[model samples]
Target: MKTSLAVASATVALAVLFPFAAAEAQQAKPQSWPGIKRTDLQRHDLSAPGREVIQVHVDFAPGAAVPAHSHPGEEIVYAIEGAMEYQVEGQSPVTLKSGDVLFIPAGAIHSVKNAGSGNAAELATYIVEKGKPLLVGK
Candidate 1:
């Protein structure tokens, strides 16, 4: 009877601790977005579900242009090198030089075109909302 009681107590303790062990197992380790390169444009997913963020780098060749697209979250661009033209929905295209920043509202259609005859590069950070599309149109 004493051995039976001991076995029951150990079983109860294990059941209580099982959930914590499972939770610890469920925790995700830190990871970097693969395929990030400095010489070329790249898109990287930073987090999951409750923390979704996409990082896009634009390395434009001479006179390169990105077609109009809509973002699910508010998107912003920081021009790192060269000049480019920005066009947003209901707004005229504006010339943006290096070191300039632009704010794009959520669901706004926009495009980026390199203005200069040389290469233009930009580092962009996007705050993506859950279930929101990153690109609206082709």
Candidate 2:
């Protein structure tokens, strides 16, 4: 299942998760995710004063791979299309297809590659510190 990139507004839970809607604009900077297309969505402040939450849409080209990297904060990925072979530090690779959800702790080294012939997509949610970059290249 190849799902196109869909942009939706925030929800209550998402708002709660990412509370800084007031500073939504100009916060989500586009990222260069090798072999992938990334659409950065709204970024909001978390209930915690200095923390923030950001959401993004990522599409992996067939056989594409995202280089090993780490997030400054927690990352939650929900597979929306096709399948992906995902690996994290100290963990075996896992195949995540539609409906699969994976969580990566902050600073964990990881990478992902499309495991299917078609494209793959996922929703990535990040809970990070305010003004900090979301991803850190390893």
Candidate 3:
């Protein structure tokens, strides 16, 4: 997939695992994310009409990856454990470690891989349109 992190990076100022995964979570079902584990900690409807923010916690097995995907919201990521290789379409891959931050724009295709010997985890905050799906697998 083209590394398109630039738009997402710029937009955070922008955009998870799959459409069904998000759908399942929304329905309060157990969510299964390929190559990773996730928890939607909270969803806050913004005061701005039609906007909302979601907090997600994710963990990837060492060397595991979430395939190319896009979202309908801007994602801001903060690394929590180990390291991750984040690539957005048309952009150079960025290695994010604990305490590092990244921005992803809505609808920008991207992929993330664990880049360390141990599992990697991150916190993602998404600002998105109300009622829109969180992820779309490519």
Per-residue CA lDDT of candidate 2, range 31-124, in tens? 3444688766767788998898889899998978887878778999999999999999999999999999999998899989999999999999
Candidate 2 regions exceeding 4 Å error are: 1-34
Candidate 1 lDDT by residue in tens digits, 31-132 = 121221232133345556543565667677776676677777777788888888999979988888888999898788897778888888788777777544
Pairwise lDDT winner, candidates 1 and 3: 3
lDDT of each: 0.67, 0.80, 0.81
Stretches > 4 Å off in candidate 3: 1-22, 25-34
Q: State the local distance difference test value for candidate 2.
A: 0.80
RMSD of 3: 13.3
**Angstrom error at residue 115, model 2:** 0.9
Output the TM-score of candidate 2.
Answer: 0.75
> What are the clashing pairs of model 2?
19-45, 20-44, 20-45
Q: Could you tell me every candidate's TM-score relative to the true structure?
A: 0.61, 0.75, 0.76
Question: Model 3, 104-135: lDDT tens per residue?
Answer: 98989998999999989999998988876677
Positional deviation of residue 5's Cα in model 1 after best superposition, in angstroms = 50
